[model samples]
Target chain A: MEESLDSYVDKGLVKTYLFTAVIWLCIATTVGFLLSVKFWWPAFLSNIPYLAFPRLQMVHVNGVAFAWLFTAFFGVSYYYVPRLTRQKLFWVKGAWLLYFLWNFIVVAAVIEFLLGNNKGLPYAEIPIWINYIVVVAVVIYAINIFGTIFTRQENQLYVSLWYLMAAIVWSALNYIIGNWIPYYWATGNEGAMLNGFYFHNVVGMMVTPLGLAIAYYVLPIGTDRPIYSHKLSLIGFFALAFIYPFTGAHHYIYSPIPVWVQTIAIVTSVLLIIPVWVVITNFFGTMKGKWTKLTESIPVKFVILGSVFYLLTCFQGPMQSLRSMQKIIHFTDWVVGHAHMALYGAFSLFIFAAIYLMWPIISGKEMDKKLGNWHFWLGFVGFSIMAMVLWAAGLIQGILWIAQVPFLNTVWDIQPYWVIRTVAGAMMVLSFFVLLYNMWKTNKEAASMD
Target chain B: MKRSGNVILIAGFGFFLLGFVVVGLIPWLQPKQSTHTIVNLKGKPEPVNEITGAAAKGRLVYIHEGCWVCHSQFVRPVSGEKQYYGPVAQAGTYNYQLPMLMGKRRIGPDLSDEGGKHTNDWQFAHLYDPNSISPGTIMQPYPWLFHGSSAKPTKRAVELVAYLQTLGTDVAEGTGYKSYWQYKAAQVSAVSTVVSNTPQAVREGMKIYNANCQGCHGIKGGGNGPAAASLKPAPWNFTSGKWMSKYGTTDKDIYNRIAQGVPHTSMPEWATTLKPNQIWEVLYYIKTFSQKKTA
Candidate 1:
């Protein structure tokens, strides 16, 4: 604490994960923009087998969900654990091992996707051998995290630690079940059920809780105030743990999976509102008198904006799970819109906040505020237009479909919307480059200061 | 508070297990047998045939291509999908499929009953370049699946097409194709009737013609629609009246040809897509094109 030389929290490790995330964010968003282009012009970059729509789709998805967001979460975890526990990160060498192993899994998964050697399980398309490596990486990560907590100077565990701990356990179980049982042990109906479980759990249990851990930590820190109610976050934490795993089957409402499972998915999906409501209350309540600070502080502004987006996404989630809504929305770009609001709008924005809040600590210099705001506005405007366009297009497609119009007619109707979506996506794709430039300048300034 | 971390881990694992039981285990353990069928519309239980040979290899090609991401296999009963696609899909219908490409998104139409919807040649042509037979479609072309030309399908293409034809053969081939054939089987021969084209018939025929036939056959009944550019053997110009009397091609013969579809051509079986009345009306509308040639 006396010296400003290195860091007790391992700043080098934190920067590795955070910077890797920014690079992947640029690549992933650009890939995603190309995907939107393919909706209107399927031949765009489609002449090559590697650049085909299906190939790039897997790459774009894993790039965003696992590559960008997952590494960012790891950055937050490494940065927070030492601060929370008041102890140095345990087995520092093991952390670096995890860094290499995890990155290898992601890189390998992308190459396999392009090469058409994928396992053909949508998001779980990484070959089985690579999946095994992923399982190993998570286990090492779990041990490293728990070991630090186990040897902490502080006897009392903070609420963020609780969510972090639970998130890790759930993720370990999630990857094992999601990858193993579906492909190896079963197929057909059972395989599908497990795949569905794995699919939603990747977002729900893994990313949601991990991101919420950072939200709980940083909202108070970013605002320079303590959280609103510690007890409220506890209630939200437990509620999320119990309800999230059951909501997977909502992805397959009218599917041949048993009627009871579908009912359970719908009911549990609605029940998720409790935890979501609790988060909204806790977060907005923390921002009470510091609302003016949000005008100047990028981190506070982004976190608060992300919370509002999270509220919209979670409310829409349960409503769409209902049979009446699912009938229209399922298999449509409406779900794509909803997914964007969750992963990109809510969680990615939260990570953007985390990157800004922690960047000075990692790089030893504050990021440029002007560029940060530019990135923020571009992302917000671009993604907002994209989500709205996709939702309207999906609803129109759904209506025409229900009317028994030829399937091709719906495709024809959405051409204009797809073009608009591509434009909006381009703006979003452009925003990531702004962030990347900011990251580079900030690091350069820090290096010259040293 | 230190021990609370262990408790949280235990409790989290427990909740996940409970979810696993409810969402995954119970349904998997149910006593239901994996039968390969559901009853056809004929009130008879039709046994679903197991895909084998080239179709089996084609199934892998389908998976590798990630076709399931866009094309769903199941046809749900809700949303009046019964009329749109043939037969509400049952669980047993997909029991034999390995990963069960009963996909979620309908970026393309549900392929649950794609079998017999188009002839083998149409499948080859469509797969080679989707925009050829289907104008303005965003489906990616599979030129790699073919050997140099649309006509020269590689082994994988044939296998893929073979698998496509096996999609919903257990039930009726398609919603309209079965009904059209059934209705036509009972209708008396129309070869003797020199009846002129009724105005109502022409109007109805024009609507169906614009919807289905105009993609290949031009609006002016010339073989020059937007999709006609890439088609081999090209669409027949209905407005060219010289061929009808020279070949003694009767009106009845043309009507059957329209339903059955021309072989080795991009003209898909309207029987698979259009009802009998629609075909009859569209035929009358096209006949007016030939009358223009005579005029």
Candidate 2:
């Protein structure tokens, strides 16, 4: 037995990209609970044009950022590139034609953003011919993850393949600077300073270097212990690829460009708190005395609650890039609760702790630990009551629109914090239906005990 | 030191092309501020207007009806939103705009000088039913930009109200409403009847203020009144003490300036012959002519 069969790779394209990332995280938590009940029912289903809340908030922000966090980062880099290149998948039918052409280009971009056929940017709303089908499916997944790291059987190259080869070339150059030069060569405020370097380098170089390369490859293999330093994770991966490409023009601090390019985007967004505190202090110094594997692992308590929400989304992204806190929470709802505390509290709780550490090694069984602690306490108490009612209704609509008060009285005093952020987005859509019913009852109890 | 994948793909695509040549291709290959100035339509200044024909197909039907995702053309000088959306935005105010709706979201408001602020039948009754002309408007109601049960419109609501009457009026041309179209062509002709807060509606609001604001506020509200010597920031005097700190001492800000008139002034709109309690009995007989010029 070739030292146990499971040693090879493409576990059927990592169970079809984690079953299309739990069906686009239940269609992005039912289009983010109908865009948080259309922010306190603004004619809720506005005589349906695909249930408009501006195309269901761009289908809940491209179905939770590119069909559920880029199909759970291509099902955790096709189950850790053949278990860190012991060698296997160089091109198994080019990974089933990149999983049916990346879910038929995200179902033709959620039917071209529900037919409003958009391109209004924010995370590059699809339809520039689906950004050339996501630049030919990120160049056929960077030639099948660099052709299985040049025929390796393991030749020393970890630190999660240097953050998955610089997050697949910084997500194909942040989808051509956030959608082909602001959809064809810039314009006004130089296309809002190149769409603030494609809105914070598409979450700082593509989902914070693929969610810190699956939290530095699932925190030293769920605390057996290792990565405390390796030269401080190679200086927190070249200081987060040179300060997240100059910290996305600090989301254009005080707009009309030039202010020395918003003080070099507020000094590289406060030098991104030095690669978010040296990769969260090397994942809490590799959980020192294997801190009782956080009460016996459910992937080490979702890697210490996603490194404490990636250190509170890099300390509220460098104190909301200064300029007096972007003159009071720039465009309020406190940057929509710091973009859902960095895409659902720090990279969807580190892709739900790398899908509860690769779904019991791709459904061999084990889940139901009280349905993974009620899907991690209903996604950590519904993302802390939806990031404290969108940062206290964006500091009471930026101190009542800076005391001038009357913009419909701060939209009727933030309608009971938008009805408690639609009951914390319906308890984070009932924690993704308790994580798709505990990964369909741990894959039908491991295919009826094989 | 574990490197080679062609030196980490040429230093990660050379720090992604040196952060796209230091924040997006050298400020998109510099050079812009060529020439600028606006005013024209005979008020003079001219030099550029540019956005051609039917306001460039009404800015592609305002980017195909997304209305720049809840308006915002820029303004920001912070907090008084540069006295609520007028100047502030320039980088050659998007010289021939090729796609720069500069919108991020204000939810509503900040149309960066929403040109000639209302009228074209109040932007076609606030785009046909914005809570029937702003009664707690949360916007959304382009009654498919009109026609059936007519208010005519629809050539995409007259090219989206001729691209919102050319936003910020071709870069600061006497900040619009060109003298409220010569005071609504001298209000076609005149008025009389009144009632609502009777004492014969404060004696027909003192004969509707000596037949419409004593020619222009003077029979001693003091703004010299005889068409306030052909206006232009001349009027407002209601015996000074700065008329309730310049036109705002609520009562719904003097019944929304006697039903929305002020836009680039000459006053007019006494809501077509007053009457919301005869404009609250002519704002309680103009606060008793500002308490008879403070006694």
Candidate 3:
């Protein structure tokens, strides 16, 4: 069994997935920077079809979510499943094939976006063909991971495995129901309401579950302590699955979507805080005597920081769902800021922790401490500044609109904040490259020692 | 209860399916209904004011350009949107559209009732180069609309213009097409060829033109202002006697076009931008350029 597991742990595939993720991080964050600049200078690089505001924005979002976040999640899943199951992957060859296929779909979909063959949805903008490909990939992950679990060397299932299972099933269903059904099933308000559910599910169901799974697995390991309460972790998992899916309609709060549906969305969104609190308490409680580990371990610092941002994102999400608050911030830069806080500051930080924790074990080499610190501080500070500026911009724009100020004047007023965002985005991009360099150098040192 | 991976997967799928059924499936399966109407080309009643022909093609162009990304088509009851954009758009307002482009952001004003807010001429010019009309507009110049030069619109430009003019055609609030053409015709045929030519009127006209028209139509009425480079049909040259004679450039004609901008041109309706007295004064100033001989 040990020999079989040794053969199954393919560092080459793991390294490839991480490398692809970092490449996307660099490329997509630069696109994000360019987009922020476009807010201030609408015509800059706009002559190119792909460089235009809307298309470029889509590329940045899709690329970051699929190429950067999901790819890292995929790599971590491969590393994680074996450790939890105490067995090799059910099909290593299939995992390798899925990796290439996933990258191809992401690249092809991005090209399609530039060529204007988009499906016209916000995040599910990938064409129908590419959407099908993603469905196939999700199914493969389910079978492979579940197959390993069935033949596990250990009988006990960890809390992280439950989230992993739920994430996989929900992700597949979310993609199909959100992307496919909306095309033919509905139109007008009904379609918008359905699409809204699909939109939030992409983040709430997929990213949130996978991110929490990583935290549940890594937080204990990083701080060298067992979780405080197994029951709390279980409750957090089920609560999230129940509440997160119903909260999508809150996006269309003031729209023509039936008032009841909007109210349900608001209530479910508030209920989401229960899972958030449970999970946060479990993480912080695990650190009761090991708070000093946060200063000692880079992975612990990232995991702890992610928990704080996660708390902020959940709190802010419920507040924004309120009717009075949605009136002001729904369509403004505040939503943009909130999205970044959740996706980048919270989940991306968790993904970085996974990378840091797993890299040494996989490569058998330690990361450069100085470069890792640079990566953490730069990313944390840059994202915080960008989020704050965008939130402030959103509030100002909302108030000005309510006061009946000319729209163009509001656009001009937000120019300075956008400039600040561009600089912050650049720093975030720089941090990603710093991370890539650290990983590469560590790998090189390992190879030389061998 | 002890749960295995398969059991967890099954439970998760079931939970997600419940939300999917409640929030997604039920709403989608329900019948669509709307009260909006329009007369078809065959003069029959249509359920919805269906967009067809050039207008249909224009909708494709709008999506291809991703115009819906920035401009929402609906207006909410809250946010004082009715005051800004015309009416609070019902769900039915967008029923005719297949993948409704009820966009998310309001980077530009809501285009729900944008069909006839400005004349066709202003729409064309705004499409070509937005700054040519609304100074400081952040909209990019669609030089592609003219296939390069603004001398005349291409076939696609004509189709795009047709689409913009039909955004709110179901409501009586759309640019009252029949009356606008009639009013435009009368203004041209019933105008006096000569201006008042009083020095005071001409001087006041110069000031009005300087403040407004000179940005596009140039100082000295030469149609060569700094912004003229980006304008289509390049602002009308008041100095060209031949062109003036062909179009019957008279005080009443100038006043009419000024008060109600020429359809499909860059010239905006000056009625709100300038007072009636200032429009009359600008007419005298335009006449002086025609009265001059090239030294």
Q: Chain A vs. true chain A, TM-score per candidate? A: 0.98, 0.35, 0.98
Native-to-model Cα distance after best TM-score fit, residue B215 in candidate 2, in Å: 32
**Over all chains combined, what TM-score does candidate 3 have?**
0.85
**Residue B16 displacement (Å), model 3:** 1.1
Q: Rank the candidates by lDDT, best first.
A: 1, 3, 2
TM-score of each: 0.91, 0.35, 0.85
Worst 10 residues of 2 chain A by lDDT: A1-10
Clashes of each: 0, 0, 5
Q: Per-residue lDDT for B1-295 in model 3, tens only?
A: 2356667877798889888888766665555423344333234444456789999998877876677777878778887766555456666566667666777777777787666555566566667766565454566566666866554677877887888878755544243443322233233333343445689988877755664577578787788876677666678887867646645565566677776676666565555334456567787788788779553
Q: How high a TM-score does candidate 1 get?
A: 0.91
Over A1-450, each residue of candidate 2 has an lDDT whose tens digit, in order, gives: 434436776565787687677778888778878767766666666655566566767777888888889888887877777777677778878778878888888888888777777877666768798788788988998898888887777887787877888888888877876787767877666777777788778888888888888888888888977789988888888888887887687876777677777888788888889878988999998998888888888888987888988898898888888888888777778787888888888888887888888887777777888888888888789789888888888888877777654365467668788788888778877877888888888888899998
| DockQ winner | 1
Per-model DockQ: 0.52, 0.17, 0.29
Runs of candidate 1 with Cα error greater than 4 angstroms are: A1-6, B172-215, B218-220, B224-235, B242-295
Query: How many backbone collisions does model 2 have?
Result: 0
Q: How many backbone clashes does candidate 1 have?
A: 0
True contacts kept of each: 0.55, 0.42, 0.41
Q: Per-residue lDDT for A1-450 in model 1, tens only?
A: 523223558988898888888898899888998889999988788778788778788889888998899888988889888888888888888889988888898899889888876666656777789888988888888889999999998787988899888888888888888877776665666777788898899989988988888888789888989999989988998899899989998887777767788899999999999999998999999989889978989998889989999999999999999999987888889999999999988899888988888887789898999999999999999999999999999999888788766566568789999999999999898889998899889999999998
Candidate number achieving the greatest TM-score relative to the actual structure: 1
